[model samples]
Target: MEIGTLQWYPGHMVKARKMVLENLKLVDVAVELLDARIPMSSRNPEIDLILANKLRAIVLNKSDLADKSQTEKWRRFFSTEQGYPCIVLESQLGKGVNNLIAAVQELAKDILEKLAAKGRKPRPVRLMMVGIPNVGKSSLINRLAGKGSTRTGDRPGVTKGKQWIRVGKGLEMLDTPGILWPKFEDPEVGFKLAVTGAIKDEIINIEQVTLKLIHILSMKFPEALKNRYKLEVLEEDPSETLKKIGVKRGCLISGGNVDTLKTAVIVLNEFRAGKIGRFTLDELS
Candidate 1:
């Protein structure tokens, strides 16, 4: 949010790319799980190009946190532009989940039919769920499996290795470690990820990120901030808005001083978990 320029080079990225390429032949389709709030930023360009020619389906995860109309626009955009079947799903709530499975089946229909024609029992469609860190891949897998089948947490990089999770009779998912791009070519991309909590806050300055989010919301989504916090929209300064939030939210010290840092954390946590409201960081326009 605060013009995030930090870059993370997890050793896992190299391993993830190698693993994906090595297992590409085994996978029938690539089910890319993207955050509904920041679909473009949540995507890993290297992974996209690596799996380019293969059958791919885009699963817009965390749909509940994002604007419904904007999510629809993204769904249509991906379908039209990339020719990849896209499905909107709240992996946490299981919304639009059946549709995700159906999309995968539709995309892999050719391979299924081929197996059937060969007189061999049609095996399950192998799919790889890939996305940047904290995009909710594990939660989605757990939801689809109807149990705590995958390790999940609020932070990023929870899933470190690969595991094959069986969703149903005809669907199997290869759960890979959440991977972030080595370098963010666009500064806005880094900012969006930070604002959306896809990037770890410890790696970046939370106070700065929160201020950046305040500015962005002021410009594009002032109404959201006003409605959520019941604070008057003012052009005074982001620091002033942050202080007001701290005072209003009772994030004050015993000395009656507003703790701006504490207030920033609360705002960011709420926004990331969708407690603030259904908002989308990126617009189609």
Candidate 2:
């Protein structure tokens, strides 16, 4: 399957956009969550337009799975260059939760002061969490709320509707369904999204995506492939390398042939799980 042929935009995403726009009036700030590994690809480009004029901050979730040095560069890029307050987060473990709250509150401090000056009662900062599917928005919300206030899954499009949940004092968040744009103009973006589990595996050709991943790792992180799969040598062909990995891991079918599908699944799962190595696919050149 050609990477360019992969295009995913369900009708629900259209509704998601409407939902976000309607709720924008209730939000003081818009927090955009991006996967730390594929920061560029994981971002919903339309978010900037939809959240325009609203105070915005970025949270780089799943930082533990991305290259540490590159993550730092991205942090500087978004916070310093892009002029959005950025926070590095490992949402699964609740790391950086406090920092996120502090940063957001600081961003809304002026608004809080304005209310005080007007003799109006102070209210918690209302935030709308937005991001592409499977970018860890729900996990971050759950971490902040200190419970499973929203349903979460490893797959994409898990959150179907919006829900408002109050975190501790001075913080309330509106959780919305993940939204991807109508189409990907760049094929590499689609491949990155698919490789990172932002797109559902059932809808895409996993074998092709895995081959692309192997080719990328072979060039950029050869040592990771060797170390994780115990491959002493990698073939020039990614397909051959995948077969070698299959043989090493014993993914064989009848007649002792490598089960390419199973092998692809394994490689993709391991890559997403960060078992291969910490990587940052969207390198800043």
Candidate 1: minimum summed lDDT over ten consecutive residues — where?
151-160
Error of 2 at 284 (Å): 1.4
Assess every candidate by TM-score: 0.87, 0.91
Q: Write the per-residue lDDT of candidate 2 for residues 13-83, one digit (tens) a residue.
A: 67777877877776888888899999988887776788888998899999999999999999999998999
Regions more than 4 Å wrong, model 1: 1-5, 10-12, 147-163, 175-183
The digit string of per-residue lDDT tens for model 1 on 1-285 reads 345447555675677777667656557887788889988888887766778678988989888899999999999999998788999988878888889889988999998899899999867787766677788777776777774343322323423344566776678776553344534778787878888877777787888888888887888788888878889764558888889989889999989999998999998988887776788888887
- Clashing residue pairs in candidate 2 are none
Task: Return model 1's CA RMSD, one decimal.
Answer: 5.2
* Poorly placed runs, candidate 2 (over 4 Å): 4-11, 147-163, 175-183
Candidate 2 has a TM-score of 0.91
Candidate 1: Cα lDDT at 156: 31
CA shift of 41, model 1, Å: 1.2
| Top candidate (TM-score) | 2
